[model samples]
Target: MSLTEDAIEKIIGKFGRYQTWILVLICVGRIPTEMQLSNVVFIIPSVNYVCLDEGAFNATNYCPCKYPEYDTSTIVSSVTSTWNLICDRNQLASLAQSMLQVGILAGSLFYGHVSDRYGRKIAVLLSLLSEVVFVAISAVVPEFWIFMVCRFLIGTAVGGTMLCCYVMIIEISGKSFRPYLPGLIELPYSISYASLAVIAYFLRDWRHLQLATSLPWLFVLFYYWLIPESPRWLITTGKRQQAIDLLTYIAKKNNRPTENIESLVIKIEEQSLKENEQRYGTYLDLFKTSKIRVYTLIMALVWMCCSHTFFGINQYIGRLQGNLYLNVILSALILIPGLILVVIGSLYLKRKLSVIISFSVAAISLLVFIIIPSNMENATLAFAFIGQLGAYTSFVQVYLYCSEIFPTMVRNSAMGFASVFARFGGFIAPFVVNIGIEWASITIFSALAFCAALLCLMLPETKDTVLLNTVAQTEKNKVVVNQEST
Candidate 1:
């Protein structure tokens, strides 16, 4: 069966009232964002453990903590000495956390497709429950391989959750609130990062931390009761009665009554029953359309540059100079202003203008860090701080634009389509830093700057009008927006 433009229009029309103010207030729904943050922080210590590997650096000297155990003491060894079983080395530990991202790169596609097929509520529940189990198991894994496997399983859970929550909020929330609600998920990262630091301060051991982190996922079960099934999805699946009931329930909750909900339901069902039979293509369809191909590829480059630069900069700072925690604190601090600017820019200014200005400024700031002589320690700190801010802002802006521009049907898959480039960036960033900085730090950041500049050329401006309302609409406006000038 062929899908019709009329069906797509009906879907959009059904969502149009979602943008209303009262509806936005009522649907201020939150997913399990904090739980995921705890997991991230739980994993970060191992990621940075190379900072204290083999007891090479005295914790008291650099840390000034005035305590021995405040460090990654040979304590894992101290305890394991009494037992036959042992935790793995630094390499395995780091790889354990990273393996999950590997799992994410692999699983994001199928996870997203499944949600688009069956239902958002079910997908999110399954993802969260599976994550809780795997992450908990990972905390207790005796064998190194089992731990890695569990960690990878947790990654699969994350892939599912990210896609599901995004689709769920947009699909269920009123059209008025979609942009703001989605923006909420990203801007709250500062709070999440701060919470992680505080939690890590209290729970120092990686295993205990992992358990502490995984525990909140149990609370995600609350979502089963609170979060609604996506009405758009119900409509898409031809569950018209369910959709009408859900919509009526929402109307009642907001003090607005649906007078002809029964008639509306019958009419919508009759209209859609013939139209929605066409099976959605695989995630590969993200690249199948000429217009989608351009959109996906450009976003891919932006993802590649942003992830590569961020990771590369972190490694460069960790190895070359500067304090680890200080850099992290500074980076986290920058996120506040970055997020504020994103909210202001995305709402008030042109979305595409923000994207260009963001990437271009990031490129310029990075160049400043590379070219300028930084004899003073504070100067280095200031430069890195400012450069980080620019990069962070650009990163947030790009993600927001991505959410806006893609068609509703393939949004998650389109987002996932950029995963390969983003993952490649993660893979290549450290290598590039290690090799490129042999000549100078300037050379290293210059590479990042260049990628930013080049990627900016491929993006389309999405400041005004509705985003990608139809296939023809998406295809027509896809002339790449140049990042250098406008």
Candidate 2:
């Protein structure tokens, strides 16, 4: 009877809490798909890139490399001056993407600290709002150098979006809804990504594409009304008053009543002092202890696996070596099944098995491409397309696992480390796909698949385990979250 009671409590526990699917949507909802497609123009030096020139990277963040100073005077003429440099022009565009990733890394890593210290509302709102500004600035950079800076800044903002939203959704939903919520986030993100391709198909010019993608950020201002502060964080941070108030708000929004809310909600069970220590927002902390170190390391590899194939397919059009339209359609095609598989898995399969199975399938699918050979009629193209379906499933699992494995306080930070790895893969994507595959596409896909398969071994099963409360809690049972209004 107690077992049944616990299960009931768990369901009740999840009511109105941040569900995983909603979190997934928030994370990927506004990805600048159009910007990436349009920005492809920047790779061609002869195109003569022109826009506002603002310094890239740490023109704001606490890093270095601020140079060339934001100057608009000769932006057009200066960029045109490099007409002869067209052969090597991809360096700048790739560099811009890399810089943007730096910001993403920063945002992902540090925003948790901010969210932990302040509130998720402030953290998420500030991050998205900043992206809005950066996106616009990226659209209007007067000089080539300034554009790169804005891109990096924009990356930083979007980086925070994924992790923060992940946490937010988990904190809001009921237990039964949590896993599904995480994958649900992918739907909107996929839509946004494909839309970029669709819009780029029409806009053509980088500036216009930039405008098309970045302007939507203005819509984020609506978050001020649509979103709420994370109730879990509020509860953990000793803001019971705010937590309760937020709960009331969610109940109201969901059409559920607060008349019996107190009885309906079961407070979480808080931890003891040593277990109570919050996450230290630093690089050392990621490697501070054994369990965290293991999770962090495995997550890095997982990031590599996810990013390698993810961006690999996205960056290399030649790999498809097929119809451009067909390649894109295939790329977009994977999202549907990907989301479907995630839903099916989360509802039916155990978490670990689902993840391993998905990863294994993707790896094998990738390997199949090598044996099938690109020369065969539609072999490589069809394989690449199918493999991406596996990649999408694997992708959602990473987010689900990461969110469940880290303490709520450091969720953003740990995800940040993972993001850095993923971003690094994203940064290297064009080069690996464009250059490496020139020699052999099969070899590239084969290596990536095998690596993913191997990395899946290091991660322990996070499903059904209590969600992590601290680095020390990884190998043991789930870290117990407090249920009371301390």
What's each prediction's TM-score?
A: 0.75, 0.79
Count of clashing pairs, candidate 2: 39
List CA RMSD, all candidates. Answer: 6.7, 8.7
Q: Compared with the true structure, what per-residue lDDT tens digits does model 1 show for residues 1-486? A: 112122322333424443243223222222223344224323433222222434447433332222233235412321112111213233443454356666665556666777767776787777767776776776676766776687677767766766566666555543334335434655446655555556655665656666766665576666677666766566656677788888777666555557766665565455444433433434766776786788788888877777666555554554335544445556666678777777777666666666667666666666767655656666766666676666667766666677666755566677666665665665555446545344364455546656665766666655533333233335554443233125
So what's the TM-score on candidate 2?
0.79
lDDT agreement of model 1 with the native: 0.56
Model 2, 396-471: lDDT tens digits are 8878878777765566677778888887766766556546344375456556656766776766655543444345
C-alpha displacement of 359 in model 2, angstroms?
A: 2.5
Compared with the true structure, all predictions reach lDDT values of: 0.56, 0.59
Superposition TM-score, candidate 1 onto the true structure: 0.75
